[model samples]
Target: MTRNLILGALLSSLVLLLAAVSFIWTPFDHAAMNIPAKLQTPSAQHWLGTDHFGRDLMSMIMVGARTSIAVALVAVGIGMGAGVPLGLAAAARKGSWLDELIMRGNDLVFAFPSLVIAILITAVLGAGAVNAIIAIGIFNIPVFARITRGAALSLWEREFILAARVAGKGAARISAEHILPNVMNLLIVQGTIQFSLGILAEAGLSYVGLGAQPPTPSWGRMLAD
Candidate 1:
């Protein structure tokens, strides 16, 4: 299982590698249309053939990869940034009103469907990459909140954590100095998982015209059309 996870990570990294490399070079321009070459089969020149619009398919895939990676990274970053702190606070406070407030807020956010939330956000904010990022990022917040809270709950009971409490440490300070450091690894693993989910969600949004907008050559948009 661990070997499989490692292999999956490597394969995923390769897609990002190609996408980053695409910034420097692609076999053909992704935007330029070749009407005469429309729908051409894969060949030495067009490795993945051409789309119905005569855009080089391979180029589209490479460029699309960039958008996917960017959206996922930003969305996951937002989740981690906001969720981790909320979760740590909840754990540190334990039975306090702050814990209940944070957790109940998370539950409320989680109650909404992700797709509906994205659509609503895009509708209000206007459909584009920025809105899509915000939508996906918002959806991820509750997920990380739950994960972080669960993980932090256990760590809060550890000897080190208790010692920090006994050492005249404030809740916020102890959480920052102790809890965060302890759960950093867990957060990273969760980040990677959320990153993948964000990519899929971004694609779904794009497929429905709520993501990166036209001319961006998103993978979901490509698949949609």
Candidate 2:
């Protein structure tokens, strides 16, 4: 399991690094039109050939990586920022009305699929990269909250938690110092999964013309084109 986790982390990191590098340099301008090269097959000059719009495929793919990565990072940030605290609160106050409220709110958010929720949000906010990030991020909040709450609840019953309580550490401090550290591994694993999902979601939204605007390459939009 450790080896597999390390390999997964390495692979994900490499992909993200490549995506970042693509932002500074690509084989060609992704938006550059070459009418003569339109729909051309791969050749010496055009490595990945040209799209119907005469844009370079390799360039488009590279630029799209930037879009995908940006969306995923922002969305994950939103999820962790909002969900972790709520989850910790729920776990610290387990069985109380606050816990019930948090869990129930998570359930309500989870009821809708990410894509459907994205569509609704895009409809209200209008389609753009910022909207896409916000929509995907909101959808991810409940997922992380539930995961964190579950892990923290288990830790709350551990011997160390008892010691912390006896030491006069408040619930919030104990949760931050003890529970969060213990459950961080779980959060890291879940964050990776959500990051991948965010990439796909951003692409899908862009493909449907509800994400990043034109001239800005997006994998989903590229596929759609």
Candidate 3:
């Protein structure tokens, strides 16, 4: 596990460095095309070769890393920001109508896969990075909500939570002060999982022509090309 963790971190950091460097420099313009040079094999001039349009694959991969990172990071942020609160609310409320409502809503969302959600969103929003983000983020919401609520529920029955309640804390205060901290580790683990899923979701959307448009490099679109 430790070895895997280190390897994952190293790979993730490498991708991040590549994306950051791409903002400043790349071997060639990702959007520029030389039809004559198209489909060339790897060489010193084009480390990863060139696409059919002669755009540098290495440059495209670098820029696409940036797009994938941005979409996944923002989508995870949106999921945690919105879903955590809803989950906390549901947990605090327990068996109340609010809890039922929130869980049911999560279930409803879970019924639709991210791809289906992306398709529905793109059908209306006309396919773009923003729409892809929305679709992935929306799917992430239910996942985090369910995880948070489950973890929070377990914590609510703990001695610390009971003590907080005994100190005259209300449901919201007890939840904020006592419950949230206990479940943070679980949330972090789940967030990492969701972040990976966000990347796949973005790629799938792009593959289907519902993600970042042309002139923008995307792994999925590159594969499609």
TM-scores for candidates 1 onward, in order: 0.94, 0.93, 0.96
Rank the models by TM-score, top first.
3, 1, 2
| Highest lDDT model number | 2
User: Please, what are the lDDT tens digits per residue for candidate 1 over residues 1-225?
Assistant: 999989998998899888999999999889999888999999999999998889999999999999999999999998888888888888878889998998899888878887788889988999888888998898888788778888889988899888988888988898788878878898898898888888898899899888898789788899997
Cα RMSD to native, each candidate? 1.5, 2.2, 1.2
The list of candidate 2 runs beyond 4 A from truth reads 1-14
The lDDT ranking, best first, is 2, 3, 1
Pull out the clashing pairs in model 2: none
Q: Lowest-lDDT window of 10 residues in candidate 2? A: 14-23
Candidate 3 Cα misplacement greater than 4 A, ranges: none
Error of 2 at 137 (Å): 0.4
**Candidate 1, 181: how far from true, in Å?**
1.0
Pairs in steric clash, model 3: none
Indicate the residue-level lDDT of 37 in model 2. Answer: 77
